[model samples]
Target chain A: MTKFTTRLPLIGIGVFAVLLLVVAPAVLSEHWISNLGKYCCLAIAAVGIGLAWGRGGMLVMGQGVFFGLGAYAMAMHLTLETAGPGALPGFMILYDPLAPLPAFWEPFRSEVFTLVAIVLLPVIVSAILGYALFKRRVKGAYFAILTQALAVALAVLISSTIRETGGDTGLSNFKYFFGYVLNDEANKLMVYLIAAALLVVCLLAVWQFNRSRFGELLVATRDAEERVRFLGYDPANIKLFAFVVAAVMASIGGAMFVPIVGIITPQEIGASASILMIAGVALGGRASLFGPALGAMAIGWGQSSLGSSWPEGWIYILGLIFIFVILFLPMGLSSLFDRAKGLIRRSSDEPGPATPELREVVK
Target chain B: MSVPDASLVVSDLHVQFGAFVAVHDVSFDAHPGEVRFLIGPNGAGKTTCIDAITGLSKGTGTARFGDKELLGSPAQKIVRLGVGRTFQTASVFAQLSVLQNLDIAAGLRRSPVSLLRARRGVDASVERALEETGLGTVRDLPAGMLSHGQKQWLEIGMLLVQDAKVLLLDEPVAGMSQDERTATGELLGRVAANRVVVVVEHDMDFMRSFATRVTVLHQGRVLSEGSVAEIQADPRVQEVYLGTAGALSGALAPGAEEVD
Candidate 1:
């Protein structure tokens, strides 16, 4: 098949995604719309996971670290915005009303700083970490373990600093987002729209990456890093680039998630949370263009419904789904789409009358 | 990109892995337009020497491509210096098509911004390489499905697409049918016509037919370096082949000869 024809499914997905995000909000109830917005945030993070884990073979189990970074950055700014310029945040008042506003939380008062920090913090951290890890050729399961450990460390650090980070209770109780009353239902819908739109943008960006030479090189490095090295390319740098991009994507997801979810906690940025993010990507199909995002949304939706209905049994059901997908559909749900397409094509292709040469060849 | 006539020159190269010394004081000069084959016994450290030159292994030596010092350079830098190599085992991107495998090697744009631009998927050089390596028929097929011989050719095609001046291959034709071997020998000859080709292989018939010069290595050192005919006639080369274990014994002499 030509490149254009091969891209038909991706284009179809892009259209479906646009319709779902732009049109569905009008028909769905306010609560379901917000739920979808939350799913969009998760989907954004899962897209990055798919790129790093599925395409680049870098199992980034610490995405929650970047997500948490963005989340807290935005949360701090929102908190500061709610309070007057010199006044302390409400959470700090609960811990120590006498103590002055922390020096570290001073810069987040500026809206631009928080926005920049949301993208820059993850980029800087992931760059340094990726450089060190890839330079030493730390990959496969070792890389995954290191990233998971980082998530655990971040969670522990956040949990220990009770007064500074709102302790285990986490950051919440936001009254405003960018000077607009978040309490207003219209403004809430606007936040959901922004998150949904950003998810689509992330999907487009990933689509570009999937078709680029860099994407091809990334996959090549994943498969046979030594061969890519022989091809006048540094496998480490290639992997590092993908890793950093994934981090930035995760950060953006986390930033948007804070507004939609109205909470940021150590529990959401721990090793288990990171594993949950990976589970969604793995269930969808890591290598497929649309699979990761769709899979993440599906999983997030399942959690919202299933966890609410059977909070005790939901984890078991998700585990079963993960096991089933892994055991039977190693390529994930996307492979089924491909198989179905192949079957249709086969059935549609009518056989011509058999020639003597063809008969002899078959014999 | 000076297009140095002497593309690769290794002198006093040594590779030691912990307590075990893999390669010791191995040296050679590779010139443009000549196919030099490094033939040796099973444990002769030929791969170590190649790895040392390509910067895959840490070694103490002066490996110069023109005026550029290559000993301490990274593998990517070494390639950018116009030296390309193929693994002992044919390693192609199994998930990608033959055409894509070549395009990725040909496209050489390694940068963060390069991720935004869509790859053309085929270039003139990629087309030429595909035609030259006889993989044109299977260009669209995934490389994983290719026969062993075809995969080897595809890898060579990958190197060609890189526009490499110095091509180092480890056992390019290790596993091939007689017909495939002959075809590969011809392909290597054509590839070496305009570039410096360094091959580490065990096929005596292939070396005798294809190599312009042969470097015999034994016990991590250079045993002999001369024309294929001269090396074949040397008694020391014969003794090493005959005396080494059964694995090395099977390497050169197709039928075993009495050692006495």
Candidate 2:
């Protein structure tokens, strides 16, 4: 069963990647290819959220804090490279005149520095926050509220730091990524492939972690924290490890989002964005292996297609989807397919050989 | 005997919730290899005493396991120091399979850094604990799907896997059927062979079977302490149990021995 579950996701991802690489260019326009890249970024964040919130039972509302950290780090480097030395970036000149670049933004001039910051900054922040929260034994709704507050605070701080953070407009209008012109069609396809490849890697990492002993301890902490404590394990430490990993994943997703989507706005790393990540995970089934990534991508696609046609009604559509998922499909879309398969197997099975005791025990 | 090298020693332990003292200046020594019963009426601070011993609640005075002080340590720290406990509510990992639950409990004693790299097989300790609790049959099933009696036994299995020198159990057989209770009593007898076992219970019949010595508490103080029969005949115990000294003396006169 474990082998089947592990292989199923790998096969699904391989087939999807092949389809995107071989057939997407013929079927989808350049704009749609760009949209697919954006969806892949959201799916990456969803996979992280699923690990922390879905399986680990942490209601992380401030995944945006890590996301923002990564986005800002990448955006800073891009803005600096585009502006050249000694000249202010376009947004900086618009927001504040005659002000030097912030000291923290100085190191991002080198691509290596920016890449390292994208991963390290989120990890450091998550480690600190997780240490404080988990060591104090916070869980359930309190954890959700704490993380949400972090998202709100980070967004507000970024918005208020007009000169450095580009205020509400954010840094955008990128011309190149790794010397490849962003406007070129081949470069766009490369971005999509990179996002798709990263998503598959993240899924595999999470899948392996879930099968490991840390995963068992995490699930145990989620279900019965007191029992875990009495067994000579600190539930806080177990939870903290999972939470930090999730935060780093979200940060990497946010970093990718900046280049693929050509924007780094506060709105993309705020309360709404965090909630959207959660909604996708819940709609897809948080605990199911591929649910969060698939669900987030689906939502991202819907927003691009449906929101464009009916901007005012897209949120309503998303809300309705959430309500439907929570009501009828408590186990999410994964269970729907599972139930279908079960029904098919039941119809074909012999009745006389089945034992009632076995059914009761299994149930 | 001269304390018999107690694994758990509580000296004048006092617990309070704001102004109300729930467990007041209670002290007892649970010797290694003895099953000690803490019996009391409802709201008589049996649970509070257990909480203080396990370091789950802050209390004044001293709780020591061997040479280490348990007063300021966290519950997890106390468990690591050779003390394990079960909740009154049967707190097993409801989402994990029975086998997974045992593995986690056993894995706790292992280094957290190496927990992920541990080989995938039931440790000998976990297997022995599961067999002792008679939960070997349904070990593959999720704990949430177990019957109420089975859940209680699974919790016992978890405690056994912890391998603590002192095991504190709060109402180990509170809601079990007759057969289940008998089985649980037998399990406790086997577990008490090498470790110090302290059980808080309201059922007098169940307490009398496993306890070598029993301590009775009333209004957060030790009302009496001795064998079950000795404490049952004490006048103060009579007043607390029968609600009147005269009624208790009358009830204990003739056929109490046959009932006991």
Candidate 3:
């Protein structure tokens, strides 16, 4: 029984992989497959949130900053690829036909640099930001506000810098991905497959983190910061590590978002975007292995369907549900699995000896 | 065995919160092979003095654990310097199992890369801590489910797994039953074999039974320091801990509070 229970996670992830990589594409239409791929991108970001906000106890409200970094990096490369050598992205040409491509945007033209930036940008930014905030023991609402402020600041900065960042509309109209036509049906499917596969990889990584010693320490830090310090761990450093990991995940999600969605805007990697990511994780179960991913997909589905029909109503409904979950189901919908398991165990063992009951009490 | 046989010495330790001096003019030295007890009234600054020594508070003092200066260092730095502490309330990782709590404490020496891997089995030190604290049976149980006394033991177990040279415990036996208190006293005796075990407790009986050396603090100042008998016989400790002529009766009698 114990072995079975322990293997549940491995089994769960296996099932999830099959559902995503094998079953979904086989059954779903092309459009739905693309939508699922987009949802997978958001789900990737949600996995990171689970680690940072849920397990590490750092409520990260500005994940959009990291997401924006990845999205912009990928978008820049794709945009430059579309424009070809010597020519500029359409927006840059529209603003000033003769103005040479900015020196900063020049490096992103390399596929290697863009790919590395998608991973490294968030690592660097989050490391600096995390070190500054955590070293000072800044946490709770202050940390949330600081992160949200950064996302808001980035959005404002992008909106104001039209010539530099294409203003608010963001860099769009991508033609190719890694030199392949992104608009081609097969290539589009490949991009969706990439997103789906990456989601699985993210899940596997987070699952490993959840069971590791570092994962244990992250949780210990979350529950008892001072105690962890007395145990010879700098709580700030632990939090910083989780924050960096989360940032990278959000970045990957953003990077994937561009090719699948075919757009990169300030609005997509801003305060609302970050909060929406959090909302999905919270709704699904921030602490559980599969909760954040499933929750994100659900939110994505809602946005594509219910949101498009009654946009204002969707906002109100999402708000109400979030408030409800925060108030009553702080662990989110995923805790229901644990609760159900507990019930089954109790009911099954009712007529047994008092030994298991005693163990249950002790547990 | 680094800096072996070193004593934890605190001299002229003064801690202030703005205008309020929490611990002023306090000095105490605890050597390995002795279980030191710091006993005082509610506001006597027993916890405060340890706070300064463990880098949790700002104070003007020289707290030397072996050759290392504890003051001015960060909390984790102080811990890394082989100083571990427990809070007044039992503060174990309630969500984790008793074994996991010890594992995390023992993780100080673990490499960053090693921390990424899950435990293959119980670590030697963690196993020893579980045996010492009598938590082996409940090793897999979440700390929250443990009895109150078990939680306190788990906290001590954490310090033990940390291999702390100086264990500064705050009210480790506040709500324990007589049996649990005895078990804890024995555990401390075993732990203090080659480490400085300093306990800040209110239980006079527990102190008299286990403390090899005693320091009595009153109003942020050291009132008395000696063997257990010497502290009990001191008129000042009696007066501060009790009151007036009742000091004489309170010191010798079992019903110290009633006499006061």
The local distance difference test score of each candidate is 0.85, 0.82, 0.89
Identify the runs in model 3 with alpha carbons over 4 angstroms from their true place.
A352-357, A360-363, B1-4, B245-260
Leading candidate by lDDT: 3
Give the DockQ (2 decimals) of all models: 0.53, 0.51, 0.70
Candidate 2 vs candidate 3, DockQ winner:
3
Second chain TM-score per prediction? 0.90, 0.90, 0.92
Q: Write the per-residue lDDT of candidate 3 for residues B150-257, one digit (tens) a residue.
A: 999999988889888899988888778899989999999999988999998778878878999999888899999999889778888777766765452332332222
User: How much is the lDDT of residue A186 in candidate 2?
Assistant: 88
TM-score of each: 0.93, 0.92, 0.96
> Going through the candidates in order, what fraction of the true interface contacts does each contain?
0.79, 0.66, 0.82
Compose the digit string of candidate 2's lDDT tens values, residues A18-87.
7766677678888888888788888888899889888889988888888889888888888887887767
lDDT of 2 at B92: 81
The top-ranked prediction according to TM-score is 3
Given candidate 3, what's the lDDT at residue B185? 96
